[model samples]
Target: MTTTPARERTRHEIVRQAMGLFQDRGYSAVSLQDIASAAGCSKATVLYHFNGKAAVLAAVLEPAAADLAALVAAADQLSRAAAQEFAIGEFTDLAVRYRGVMDVVQELIPFIQEMPELALLVADGIRLKGFLAGSDDPLEQDLAGFALNGLTAECRHADGRTDEELHRLCEAALNRLFRPS
Candidate 1:
């Protein structure tokens, strides 16, 4: 079995701490010094791992992308009904896990609007795979990811909805997308 390298593990901790700070204070409000103190490391250590705040945020994104990919892959493996349930549950879990970071991300929308290229990269990370069979067009696939984001946001706002309700709603949406007449 592979183990995380010491340096990489430290970097991960630094990034995690940095994420919390960024979420609470936002990107502009945060600094390398702040991250260093939050992480209980030296400024040089933070710099050694990340060139700047942007790099630190981007590093946090990499694992999030991987986690989303894993969820999509798992959904791909399930039967139609089961896949919808999996997608909903997974998406709910992700929304909860990343709400703070996502708030930071939502804060970047205006910047993304100004910088189209950056927006594209962010959108790409949100891209969904071919959740339905024979629907492999890249553009359609990309929209699915965007659609998933919409659902997740809705779920975030929904209060007092039980897990079962959320699962049913999400599964119904995905099922409609995949079911053939």
Candidate 2:
């Protein structure tokens, strides 16, 4: 059965509240009661909306997962230069856009193998090997990987910076990394 408007509103509230908690404090540290309290709802209401904390995590991750999936798909249509531009630049923008979730994502990076959604999000990882025009150059692969991790880890609170500025910074680093000896 579908949820009523009021119920759906409550559910959205619960998810929003839970995401804030999960981002503020690691997922392991957040409790259902905390979400309910933050959302101004009862524990039972929170449960009625989501079966458990894991479901809330899934809801929180859905947007980023979708964005990542789309980025990977778009990168498929292009190779090498285009792939690098799209993957690294867009990914850096994504990190800044979802500043709250970035910390949670960082925490989950290690256990991505256990989370199929995250695995799917990071599966191609700009490599696209066996997909389309895959690169075999170790240097190209290493630089992309390095840029991905470096950008995500270093930048989250982009309060004073613009998205274009961030992308420009990432592009600069990528150029340096992809530079030939």
lDDT of 2: 0.70
Q: How many pairs of residues collide in model 2? A: 0
Please, what is the whole-model Cα lDDT of each candidate in the order they appear? Answer: 0.66, 0.70
Per-residue alpha-carbon lDDT of model 2 for 76-119, expressed as tens digits? 78866677556656666676777677667777767766765455
User: Model 1: runs farther than 4 Å from truth?
Assistant: 1-9, 74-86, 112-126, 129-181
Counting clashing residue pairs in each candidate, in order, gives 0, 0
Q: List the residue pairs that clash in candidate 2.
A: none
Cα lDDT for residue 81, candidate 1? 56
Clashing pairs in 1: none
lDDT of 1 by residue, 1-181 (tens): 9999989888988988988887788877999999999888899999998877777877766666567778777776777656655665566566556655566666665574454434544544443334432256677566666656665565545566665676567656655654534
TM-score of each: 0.58, 0.77
- Best candidate, TM-score: 2
